[model samples]
Target chain A: MELGPHILLALLESAVSTAVLALTAIGLALVFGIMRVVNVAHGEFFMLGAVLAWWITDQLTAFSPAVGFAVALVLSPLLVGAIAYASDRIVINRVDYDPERTIVATVGLLYIFQQISLMTFGPDARPVEPPFNTRLAIPWLEITEQGWAVYWPWGLSITSYKLAVIAISIVLLIGVWLVLSKTRYGLIMRATQQDKDIAQAFGIRIERVYGLVFAAGGALAAMGAVLIVPIQQAHYLMGGDPLLLSFIVVILGGLGSLSGTLVAAAIIGLSNGMIAVFFSPTLAKILATLLVALVLIWRPAGLFTRSSR
Target chain B: MLELSGIAAAYGRVKVLHDVSLSVCEGEVVCVLGRNGAGKTSTMKAIMGLLPLSAGQITVDGTRLDTLPVDHVAKHRVAYTPQGRRLFPELTVRENLEIGLMARGEDSRVLDWVLELFPRLEERMNQLAHTLSGGEQQMAAIGRALCINPRFLLLDEPTEGLQPSIVALIQEVVSTLSKSGVGVLLVEQRIDAVLSIADKVAFIENGYSREVVPAATLKTDRSLLEKYVGV
Candidate 1:
């Protein structure tokens, strides 16, 4: 059970990737699961979070870098969620959340959000400093000429912010689980998921619930973006990778099942992280896409679900 | 009280209900009997605002309802248990009824009242509704509707495909609900079972509702049931 420093570092990176991927994919799954909408614009919400984080930090840097980053972290997801709520009310709900039409609408939403981010954030990739000092050395046993020894090597430094991201994500994911399982809000959403018509018959305002769930989904995407902007710069086109990876997770997990999305996200996220660390990020993405194809062909419902829905 | 006078509704260009009129006073059990595809279900759909009325109006205790949305129709204290139970299959019995309670922003206190009515539901309160048998599913559906404590209880084929014992159970429940002053508008095909509790009866035919009469009279006259229901 002895682990090398290189392998340990790679494992850590994969865990981080898994956490971010879970956050991104869960929203896609939620939208599909509850409202039966394929939100192609999910990544745009992520990109918008990073873009807003940078802008907010830039504006608030005058106060203090710490204050600026803190404010942006809190505000970005809320703003993204609010915008998503408005979009649901305006476009998605208008069409009654038709599965086919929402795909088109969200694709339109993707472009609209991208173009807006482009006009505002510019074509250049923007960077934001972490709220706290991120650099830290990870200790691990290394096999060298001497023997297996515990040491922190030159390139084995772990970022404190990355660990924070992992911690925050774990808490947030747990919070989401509690919300869906324990709260009335979750109860209502689950009801809507089973049968929108029947839910309406019980006096549920399904339109309002749809709008809020859409907002919550967007907010979740923004959450990951806000946490990861320091590691990955804010770029208008950054949404492509996250969106694709999320689709992979949601498809592998089973569309519309949150618990299933969590399991699939862990698998995809960890593997992609591990692959990227050993090989290349591009290779990681290729492998993930290949896995998506395999899952879709074999078990389209997802890994956790017993059968296709 | 639910009253529909000259109400007409359609799906697309095709009209399902050309003309329908029916009424159920407080504490009254009015069963609508008809053959298949006779607009029996369509009449309930129209009253629940599931379909846009092509013409005419729907009123509950003198308040306008035809123009209300499907969810809003429930807001007026009208509960409809559609055909096939339609309980949220994934939800636990408690959760399904909670959806009913949540609809009206009420408390979990209604659960106790519901459990008392369908005591079988009390034991399976935590079980997923889909796991229940046909009779149990029907009980859960009725329990969910009653959680709303709605003024009108609309049942579409409440006793369809049930064992005689279960049918008798539904009969008792419907009778109790009506006696408790919850107006019951039942859509059923089983004439003999429905007439056991129905105070009045209406027959929907060829997209129109007619043959309105007292159930007691219809029960005595077997020829009347044959002539109207034509079974």
Candidate 2:
């Protein structure tokens, strides 16, 4: 293989890993950043999303694949968000959203979600058919090629569906940015995140805000799950890698900053993708863990923390 | 009009405020003067529903409010600015002020009004709250509370640490608030600074709320001010 195709393949893998990893990590960062609650159930939320998406798509496949995928995309995240909202009210709020106590509660929630998915999903690993799957034969310049004419590489190729996931993630992330930066709800969320006590005193209804943010976080994770379920099958335990990767990214990014999360996700995803392609995937995971440990020891505030002005 | 009668507040089993009674009506300033840990802050917190009252009732406009939550109390036309000028330190000044009026369900127009009240805020409208000087922070805190247009304002040590110029600015703002028929419940460490604007001064000693005296009488009868409030 020529250097051009080799580098292109590495970049594509990086893009793929970056897209999904970012989608997963943003939710975790959001929940941790705003409510100061470490959502142990975040992975469970991701799993539930993928499982639910599978079920939704399976039910809708009677129609067109595009229609099935579209409905599942909309419905899966919404369902996850609703469940998370209820859990926040019933469990997290009961503990008063206390740091230690909420962690325990979320751990409990994690098991509960996993168990329920195992029971209802029947412990089966299932995949959703992609809405569209078209292969694009990648082009590269060969040294012996006549007058540097464009030529299709022998093996380098990418599927349209993977490209779609990358595009969807970009859209979803921008949507989050816009909602947080442009909308009144975003202002309220930022306010609550800054000072919960003051936000409450100012009649921001922080408890309600907490519920909403928690749900939104879960929903984002689920959205990522829905997009990725076609490439990776939906299993009761499928959320583990995304969860671990998301945590690594969020930790590397700086715990609460969204921009930090994105940049960190890109680094983690790209590295993981490239490493997994060249070596063993297990090696990639080991390297990611080491990177996280290093970042934790070095700049715990995150790589992107804006200095206090 | 806001009134607290026989209010008792405690942290754990340790009572912070004992048998505290106070009232502030429109066009009036009631200053609570006490040294550090004299339960002046405790009294303010109790009224703001930050701490649970072991005994007594709070009323505003003839309605009981002692049982309500801090936010509910605010909705009933009572706004509180806790000590340390606790603005959202990371947020811009405009965002900090907006949170104040958010309780009242007001709009950006209130932001203009707040900036008008504290012209200094307009200059640093986009700066983070933490970056503002102590005087500007205090002004932002007061401006935020005032933005709610509450019938009653509870300020805890608005002029705790400030230059005379800033103190005078605070004094002018408090007086104007009082003149506008907004009842001012001010907590002060400096009796002299507040004496000019305060209609009534209540002294707290240790955990006990002591005598309430007319601010005018305290000018001539400096003994009470001297004994209860050191300097």
Q: DockQ, in order, for the candidates?
A: 0.79, 0.64
Best by DockQ: 1
Query: Per-residue alpha-carbon lDDT of model 2 for A5-122, expressed as tens digits?
Result: 9879888867976897798899999999999998888999999999999999899877998999999999999999999999999999999889999989999998899999998888
Name the 10 consecutive residues with the lowest summed lDDT in model 1 chain B.
B222-231
Best by lDDT: 1
Writing each residue's lDDT as its tens digit, candidate 1 over A30-58 gives 88898888999999999999999999999
B124-194 per-residue lDDT for model 1 (tens digits): 98999989999999999999998888889899999889999999999998998888899999998788888
lDDT per residue, candidate 2, B81-149, as tens digits? 889988888788887787787788877786776777789999988999999999999999988887777
**Per-model chain A TM:** 0.94, 0.96
Question: Candidate 2, residue B230: CA error in Å?
Answer: 2.3
Clashing pairs in 1: A33-A256, A254-A301
